[model samples]
Target: MKIATYNVNGVNGRLPVLLRWLEEEQPDIVCLQELKAAQDNFPEGAIRNLGYDVVWHGQKSWNGVALLSRVGKIHETRRGLPNDPDPSQSRYLEAAVNGVLIACLYLPNGNPRPGPKFDYKLVWFDTLIDHAATLAASGAPVVLAGDFNVMPAERDVYKPQRWVDDALFAPEVRAAFFRLLDQGWTDALRTIHPDETIYTFFDYFRNAFARNAGLRIDHFLLSPALKDRLVDAQVDRQVRGWEKTSDHAPVWIVLADR
Candidate 1:
């Protein structure tokens, strides 16, 4: 099965690009982030028409997430990060597609460092780390895929120096990211192509994509048990060039059945 993750930015604004990508790539499962729409405005029928069974968690304006499965039932669905007491945003969603536990996340963008927003971002990462630990202990094959809003390492960003003060590249944020990986989940893309220069997101206003000045913020993390079945992993950078597309492109991985 092929599983993909995309931060579409806004479902309504980028519907055309999304439809085109779905038609061309045809992934079996897709986890979407940043829908930026309300539940009523999800364009459900339009997506279902494409032959996908959709499960969505939507809020107004800012954040939202969804999962599209072609051949599996969503056995369970969860919205918001676990233990998030005041989840005013729809930043995380979990669903069991087929037999695999899939998580779609749009981690907070803690821009303008040394601020409350940045502190919230750090707290969010910690919460995720705790949750990831719980999930990992289950020994079930899980795939955490989405826009983590984190750059794992210096190599993951185009100009490390330029992003020094950004929350995504902050030392603590990167450490938390690594700690999650250390919990036995595999960074599928990096594991397969460690030295390759790859990225999934760019700044739309700066011609970042054209210059290959982008960051690898989106990811497909697999549990250790799925390592052998890991077949292919890649970043669909081409999708970012589409009209009205998100700053992020689709990142995907193929897996063999258990």
Candidate 2:
């Protein structure tokens, strides 16, 4: 089945581009981040008309997450990161679709490092790592996919040095991402294409997308049980340059039928 992750930037503003993508890609399941809308503003009817079921956790003008499944009932497992000390941002949501556990997350883009925002980013990562441990223990085929807001390695970014002070590439952030993989989840895109020359996001500024200057912050991580079934993986870079497009693009992974 095809599973895809996309950060639409804003659900209302990008409805046309998003719906077109859904109709074209036709993924069995989709995990969306950065809906940037309130629960009541989520364009439910528009998506429902596309023949998919959705479960979303939304906030006003910032972070949000959603799961759309065409194969089974979208079972919401959790809304925000449970047990978090602070309760401010709506950045995570978990659900089960088509017998696979899925998580849609919009990890904080902690800019201006050495500050509270960056600290929160690290704390959030810890929370997600804890959640990953629980999912691993369940022995289910888990697919944690979304805009992690992390550049896994220097190669994942255009100029690593330029973003050195940014939270996305901060040493602490990279370590947290590695910790998740150490917990037994395979980085699907990196796994199938281990060459280390792929990207999933680009800054709208500085003609990043036009020049193909991008970062691979978006990801699809799979459980080891689903590793061998990995068939295809790619970043749909073309979507990033479309009219009224988001800074991020779609990342997709296809798995063999069990």
Task: Name the regions of candidate 1 deviating beyond 4 angstroms.
Answer: none
Question: Model 2: clashing residue pairs?
Answer: none
lDDT agreement of model 1 with the native: 0.90
| TM-score quality measure for candidate 1 | 0.98
Report how far residue 37 has shifted in candidate 1, in Å.
Answer: 0.1
Residue-by-residue lDDT tens digits, candidate 2, 97-188:
88788888888887778898888888888988998898887788888999999998998999788888889999999999999999899999
Worst 10 residues of 2 by lDDT: 81-90
Per-residue lDDT of 7 in model 1: 93
Model 1 poorest ten-residue lDDT run? 77-86
Query: On a 0 to 100 scale, what is the lDDT of residue 144 in model 1?
Result: 91
Candidate 1 per-residue C-alpha lDDT over 79-136 given as tens digits, one digit per residue, 9 for 90 to 100: 7878873498888889888889998888889987989889999999899888989888
Which candidate number maximizes lDDT?
1
